[model samples]
Target chain A: MVRVHNLFLSSDGYGAGEGQSLERPFGHANPVELGAWAFGAASWPNRTDGAGTRGLEDYLVRDFHRNVGAEIMGRNKFSPCRGPWEDHPEWEGWWGEDTPFHTPVFVMTHYERPALTLTDTTFHFVSGTPEQVLERALEAADGKDVRLGGGPETIRQFLDAGLVDTLHAAVSPIELGGGSRLWTSPEELDDRYHHDVVPRPDGVVHHLFWRR
Target chain B: MVRVHNLFLSSDGYGAGEGQSLERPFGHANPVELGAWAFGAASWPNRTDGAGTRGLEDYLVRDFHRNVGAEIMGRNKFSPCRGPWEDHPEWEGWWGEDTPFHTPVFVMTHYERPALTLTDTTFHFVSGTPEQVLERALEAADGKDVRLGGGPETIRQFLDAGLVDTLHAAVSPIELGGGSRLWTSPEELDDRYHHDVVPRPDGVVHHLFWRR
Candidate 1:
């Protein structure tokens, strides 16, 4: 089953802002504020510094690592630069050598680049349709489930193609004035998926969608 | 404590649909589906029929009568006809004689008409700015909170003018492809209000906004 876990969006359903750059990966929006809930959750395995909040957010955050073998993300999520990567040849992504994915990470891009390995993660730039890329990710995952990481546009492509089986979106209280929108109306998902909404006391709404 | 209780919207933040007429008050949208949560809630006073479901939806529905003395709504909400009412001269409103609102109901419209009294509810058409109309509604509400009944545009006017102190919107899982939007980005409310999100398991996300 293909799943999207802990994808943060504004109250207006925007996944990311416009004109994203290296400094502002989420464009005009604040990534810190948009993802504050997950980072603050006690169940986050990546949090090694201080104690995090224990609640629904923590439970969801902790689920990010369960049974996930490979990740498929957009080129934009891999690098802020658009078009060709020749201009910023030295760029290795915002994660540097400490990329979060321990499994194979496939990046869908128009401009292909050599596979880059960092610690336990390997960034592979592959160009294909959502199905084609999913095939490669699934093969790389062996028997494990593949996670569809997104910057909104990539997730939208998968959603439009009906390739995703489950999606978990954390709707933050803030609204991004303009940017790429995930969906104009989520009710459209009702045709293929069953929707569940869990509201956290801290002002974040977790929207879960699973295939019916 | 001006509060908007049980206001239903699409996940995209649409309160009502475009080209709303007497035949379709919610335009292309289905009122039964958009407001199904409230109708099923056990606490809804309007539900005189059998029993309703108990839980958060019920609690919010019951809160509709808490301190609400009077109601303010747009002319569109009262009647389907726009511009001059001369074309649809006989249109009294879709609510018929026994309207749900038992309080003094004020309708803001350019076309002034005599007050129509129905049961405990009286529809009074008045023309003024949001603040001006709110003043009258507040006076009519007396010590109770004034409920800003809407069709999206009307609420947007009040929200833009900063007349609304608090708003509670239920974002249903369904999506209306086209309609009047309540807000471009609800985050703008952060300047004067604090926002909270509570998602019910029934696929409705309840957005609570209160004056800071």
Candidate 2:
């Protein structure tokens, strides 16, 4: 059984982004807080020796990282281009050298592109339906957990298909007037999901749930 | 101006219960890890006591709490009743003698009920539109800030109205198979929203955005 995870950032009542620049799409909350909940222990800037503190953030970060084997992300997350990022072929990702994802990453896009190899990560671009991308991700993960790194649509597709396993959500304290929403419909959820609330000192709450 | 904040729980893809009861809605992630993020000096829990560790999580939590003057929640969060929580009328909130939201709390529901008063927190039930509820909350906040707690619909109304000020979202590592959809449309956003990304030790990422 493969576990599918979806990660996202939310606003108070608004959407995620303001301007169209990838540099600051979500606003200034705290990268450490966001990454801690998604990447877990792997969030540490230096995997080798960073002299980081060991606490709740570290524990959860490590737990999530330990479970994931491969990742699937939307083309927007993989590049800064708005539509058909192919126009600008040189743009890669916001993360410079030594990107956090040390495993294989699959990017979902409509345009075709070759596989990209960064420091310890390899990004394979797929041009097809989400199911096709998931199949490739599962193959890459090899029975390990697969993560859905989303802009929005990507996670919604997997979620609508009932393919997700566990969900961890960190609710930051800021609110966007509007941009892109994180969730879609509530009626779609039956008895399949559970809920927990973890309040952070930064006013963000960490919520987790899994399949029933 | 009154600021509206939204909060909720999500799961991995499989739709598993967060294993949350009225007692623990946060589920069963490592307590130590959660504590690290929630009880840091930056958060409200530690600012008065200095009980938790100091890190990025703490700082962000502190920033979130500092901006809040009051809170507004849906009837579901105030009580555990799902379809017709008012029918039972026996259930109250999970918070015991001393509830967390020490400030004023306005609950939106169709049923009319008496106000709930804990030590420092007071729960007021409003049976009007979200705008009315927000107006009362803003008055209660007294020129401070107001938070819109969630069931989902309540947050959606506020988002649709473009009444929120700042949004802080924590992207957890897991994905709920199904429960609540965060975003349904992209046109809901205006130019007032700004997003920033905050990475954490765990795979969680916190996105902070505010209305300008």
Candidate 3:
């Protein structure tokens, strides 16, 4: 099953705010604020100080790599550089050095490029519709479930196509007035998915969904 | 202090849906669905069965009338009938026989009419801006706190004017595609108020706000 987990969505349904640039991947949004629950969790994988709280939030952060194999993400998630690869050839990605994924990472892009390996992760730049991309990711996943990495629009494309199997969207309390919205209301998915709102004591609500 | 409590907001930040009329007070939205948490509570005063569940929701329901000496609402809250007083002279509120608001109720309307008293509550059809209406409500509240009763737009008016002191907005998990929105995002009020999101064990999240 294709899955999405630990994704932080702003209260206004934005995966990332407007004005995205090389300096600011989340655009006008402060990623630290939106991912407060995850950043504050003791189980956070990338913690520098190694000091954070534990509970449901910690559990979510720790569970980020449970059973995911190959990961699929949009072009923007791969780099701040937009358009063709010639615009910016140097693409090390936002995740410095050793990236999180230990499997093949499919970067859905219009421009194709030779697969680049960084530490344990391999970045494969490919172009296709949501279906085409998911098929390639699933093939690379071997027997493990393919993870659908997102920035909202990527997930939305799959959602509109009814290709997603399960999803865990963390609705952050912060709001961005204008941005790319995944949904006006989550109820839009009720026809195809069963949603369970898991409210953590820390006030971060996670919307869990599975195809019905 | 002027407070707004137990106000239900859709996942998209709407207070009420479109197509509002006498038959549908909340427009296309279901009032039962919106008030499910409170209505299901054991302490719900309006529970006819005398049997219900307990917890934070129950506490909020029972706390509804506490220290509330008066209520300020939009004309639509008083009745679905719009336009001048000539449209619908029979202005009995949607609350039925004994209204929940025992305190003096100020209904802000452009077309003013004589005050109507129902059982323990008195509905004053007053005209003025949000500030003017609030002033009258505060006066009617005596020494007790005033409650800003809303239908979404009403609360937004007070919010825009910075007249609201405290607010407890219940963010329901359900989503209504469109309606009267209190906010595009809860963060809009962060400039003037400190907001705390209290998540209930039952999956409901309440946003509590107070002037900084």
Q: Who wins the DockQ comparison?
A: 1
Model 2 superposed RMSD (Cα): 20.0
True contacts kept of 2: 0.00
What value of lDDT does candidate 2 attain over all alpha carbons? 0.59
Error of 2 at A146 (Å): 0.7
lDDT of each residue in B46-133, candidate 1, tens digit only: 6677565533454467667766889998888888887878878877777778788899999999889888898899888999898888
lDDT values, one for every candidate: 0.81, 0.59, 0.81
Q: Which residue runs of candidate 1 sit more than 4 Å off their true CA positions?
A: B1-212
**Error in Å for residue A36 of model 3:** 0.5
- By how many angstroms RMSD does model 3 differ from the true structure? 18.4
Model 3 scores what on Cα lDDT? 0.81
Per-residue lDDT over B1-212 for candidate 3, one digit per residue giving the tens place of the 0 to 100 score:
78887898887898899988888999999888888878877567677896664334544666567678999998877787878966668868888878888989999999978888889999998998998988888899998989988979999999888888778888888889998889888888889886766666655677877777
Q: Give fnat for candidate 1.
A: 0.06
Q: What is the lDDT of residue B6 in candidate 2?
A: 19
- The reply for model 2, stretches above 4 Å from the true place, is A1-8, A11-15, A25-49, A184-190, B1-212
DockQ score of each predicted structure, in the order shown: 0.04, 0.02, 0.01
Native-contact recovery for every candidate? Answer: 0.06, 0.00, 0.00
Candidate 2 lands at a TM-score of 0.45
Give the lDDT of residue B123 in candidate 2: 87
